[model samples]
Target chain A: MTINASKDLYAAVPDEQGRFGPYGGKFVSETLMAALAELEVVYSNLSTDKHFQQELDHDLQHYVGRPSPLYEAKRWSDSIGGARIYLKREDLNHTGAHKVNNTVGQALLAKHMGKKRVIAETGAGQHGVATATIAARLGLDCVVFMGETDIQRQALNVYRMKLLGAEVVSVTSGSRTLKDAMNEAMRDWVTNVDNTFYIIGTVAGPHPYPMLVRDFQCVIGREARAQSLAQTGRLPDALVACVGGGSNAIGLFHPFLHDESVAMYGVEAGGHGISTNQHAAPLTAGTPGVLHGNRTYLMQDSDGQIMDTHSISAGLDYPGVGPEHSWLKDIGRVNYVVANDDEALRAFHKLTKIEGIMPALETSHALAYAETLAATMTPEQTIIVNLSGRGDKDILTVAEIDGIVV
Target chain B: MSRIAGRFQQLAAQRRTALIPYIVAGDPSQDATVPLMHRMVESGADIIELGVPFSDPMSEGPVIQQAHERALANGMCLSRVLELVQEFRKSDDTTPLLLMGYANPVMYMGYKAFADAASAAGLDALITVDIPPEEVDDINAQLQRVDMDNIFLVAPTTPEERISRIAAGASGFIYYVSLKGVTGAGHLDMEEVTQRLAAIRRHSQLPLAVGFGIKDADSARAVAAVADGVVVGSALVNAMAQTLADGGNSGQAIEAVASLLGEIRQGIDSAAS
Candidate 1:
């Protein structure tokens, strides 16, 4: 589906108040307002500073492995018999995921702000590992909050964070998942606002966070736009990425948002199914509400109590999506769909065996939807799927599912 | 004047600081809230800040967070909290009651609808912690339409410019979070609070009520010396939790909480003298 590019969609968004058309705003306690304002000002200045840009670009290229390849999955595409599938290889980046891109940027911002400590909330622990990696490099103290359930599921990443000299706090409150860890992180930031900077993992949270994280992660789309033209002679027909707070998806979609000919899809984790009401597809099955400092699509009851979400992939098991995705959904600019646990597992194994590439279960959700979408298009059409992370961290989860002790 | 403003005026006239006590509705049990409110008022609570239970109360420490969990387990909700207000009003309409919680519940019930329903239920003010000054305009407008006051929090980290802005927009009284952490998580730094309260006073003439870490009678007395009102939350909730854990019935729990409030009230009165 083509959009009308006559209007400049990018220039009008997240107005001065940080609102994405009534979706995104600083819906946090008074204690956080000043810090958010300070961040907004500092980011606006440093985002354009020549020296800061050079430093960030240098770090991206040398440290985090920027310009990850756009490899065409010919065998997988031929086996499926449809659109030519190309994977934006973010899994090849340092720390093995797209998460490092934003972390590297935010860690630099933290250093520039003269903060001595940094804190982050993680689900699936990929973000925690990435944050720890950068903080170790920068010689800043790091604390990562992970839910107890996630700590058990992603032990490897937790140990990796510890080995990197970061403290991992186990959050045992409300649902024992991503949302609770975020709550703990917010509390910590509120308390330590003076000496610590919070490095949020997704395109969510209050103002400047969604904007800054998106800006940092947009490298994915920028590189993909250029790579598609250079390799395939033109931009791909479609872009696909999974939406857990929608960082990876937005990173791959934002640069192409105004490209009228490019269709974009954000896949949400469907734990059981929408019918069973046990999924985390807020954009697909939830309503607009405030949570974790922003107004966004949330999985909540009628009484406004946030509901517990379920997903095989810990990364996608959140009750709310980023507010920008809420805006994108409202404007019909992106199609938000769902892939269930079983389907994601199928895609996880399919890519691992068929292409010798093991995709993170979170990324497998996107691959699941991509397979269905690819089956409908002609071979001439090309689809770019964001391989968000490597599946190495998910080995334990997969093994446990198969009832194996290992 | 609204009930909240009138009460503050009366307290100022008597040179007595207002004693505000916060409790989660239906914490011990759904049937226990209205009685607790009445008991608190009798025990010398000038204003009642009833917590509307939310699944995620991020601003609360573990003490109040557990209270919210217990309340939710007892099936408390926004509508029920309003119903409790109406129930409390049935016996005594003089003591001002305010709903204190997060913003999502109010957002769930449309702003106008919530304002109308809450005002009709005899609520005097609203304190949704997560809705800061920048985002309170629309909801504040709705509350104004219903003649209800939209209260705001002034934190220790709040700058003077933002404080003035918040003071300009806020009605009723301004709530001063005395520490840099979540509710019930920090020790009261009396000097810092006094300094911040003095700073906030320069920006607004409205009465300032201080909360967060005003736990026992001693802490309440210390804060009362510098502010127009002293608000206690986790201590009262903890008292009730202890009563329930010790196998005390809801009545005993109410008695325990009321006893603590009475001591706090005495502390405030003693500070005034």
Candidate 2:
């Protein structure tokens, strides 16, 4: 289980047992173990298969609109007064976010496996919308379990999912939020394993899922790597991304891990602040324990009861991060930082005014940190911020927060 | 003798199937638990599976979910659940007690601490619904140090190779979930049960218990015809839920559940004849 720090980190990871240095492993029930094993074999075979790769590539190009452009944010960089900044335009994806990348990949897997239905648990409803979109395209029956609280906050996306022909199930469980939605989804998945595929939106579930999600999402890093060189004539000096379940962050960081020159910063949701016990910063404020499926840093109390996590953005409001992110954080390969609610709000406004790009509240956490970080770097250097999603889903939430009802 | 083995031996000697009923430890109230256990045994229960209320019981349906909510509302936790087992042992030492729940609470307490405390508290076995054989080996090793039994679940989708793998570490009898869905779901098809059990018997020498869909006396009899034991859960808890909805308390739950168990016992015995 020793990680060879000298070698390529990604290759060493998720070894035969799916351990990302004691963080990732299969911790599901017996009923799910077989399913995971089945998926592992299928994914392993298909990941290397040339036709499968080609089909995935074709879909990413024609269906999902991949190679999401890396745009240079000249105005925002000048306003910040330091390093030049570039935006990885994942917000431009068909569903207005990077979540569709992984969903398209998983829904394809479901089709390959002959599964007739797809189910997912959503937080801000972005993942739900993305999953519903893909399922609709593939003509698969889709069901989304969204927390009642989140469903209320993001009604527009909920309606979008209904338009896509997916059933939206309101979860009224503990906390009435993302974690409970996940619990209900797991329950549903365990029940309907025969003909259904549970398309986990993040890189944080049991074995093969975290690995598979990271693999599917690695396209971001892959495309960004090539795009950075083609645009800037070099790998960007630094990479910044928001970490909820850490899928988009990992997607954008994986290809750059072996490049010793690039610095990576993962900004977590510091709801109020880490010191105030109201943040969703597990890697920054919490300890390692098991939750969902894998062993990862979790925002849990001393008794192992998962604590309530908070953030203005529901997408970044999870108690646990991806297990690979935990391994990366421990190895010091990535600097894990935080941005509180106010800072993200300020960044949201700054991005909209300067760059004319309305960023999702979740992605604004990364932008907020990048604003201060760019101030310290040289002008010759560059940074790429993953604009993981658009702000369309959060307008009403923001409007209500600002006391403007409409 | 381990309580599970001893009870199975007694049941085999009498040529009767085990009628094991499940109940949440503090469903109505903690004070009502030990008495409820006694009443269930008085109505021909061979063993008792006491549910530890978890914040999320993913394998459960509406009935058991409400039972967990009620039990937690009554201040039931892992510590209190162990204390309830200690109380149950004071009067009844013969019936095997299994602490069935999810892995989080048990893991939160630390496996060694919880295992030692639960074994010392007279708990004979456990069935963590979420702890499969892969993730359970560490805890199984801990429980084995104390001679405790860690029961595993086998579903219809379980492959034979996996059944062998799960069977290796399993100490107590294997619980075969009768259907693909959660507890309190589906109607029992004895034909499917017979076929799945036949597949499971190839890899497991331990006694087999069928749960999940065994609802009434007729279904219980149908399951008991093939299984070594029939576990009835939501049916008993639903009885209590109905009684409480009717403005009744633990006294009424005791009567309703005992009556239900008595009928199931008769059905099981009659099926044997």
Pick by lDDT: which candidate is best? 1
Give the chain B TM-score for each candidate: 0.99, 0.98
User: What are the per-residue Cα lDDT tens digits for candidate 2 across A180-260?
Assistant: 888888888888898889999999988999999999999999999999898879999999999999999999999889888
Best by DockQ: 1
Using TM-score as the measure, the top candidate is 1
> Model 2: how far is A320 from its true place, Å?
2.0
Can you give the TM-score per candidate against the true fold?
A: 0.99, 0.96
Task: State in Å the error of residue A77, model 1.
Answer: 0.5
> Candidate 2 — which residues are off by over 4 angstroms?
A1-4
Q: Per-prediction DockQ scores?
A: 0.89, 0.61
DockQ, cand. 1: 0.89
> Which lDDT tens digits does candidate 1 get at residues B79-115?
9999989988998989999999999999999899999
Q: Rate the local accuracy (lDDT) of all candidates.
A: 0.94, 0.90
TM-score of chain A of 2: 0.98
Candidate 2 chain A weakest ten by summed lDDT:
A1-10
Error of 2 at A108 (Å): 1.6
Report the C-alpha lDDT of model 1 over A148-203, residue by residue, as the tens digit.
99999999999999999999999998999999999999999999999999999999
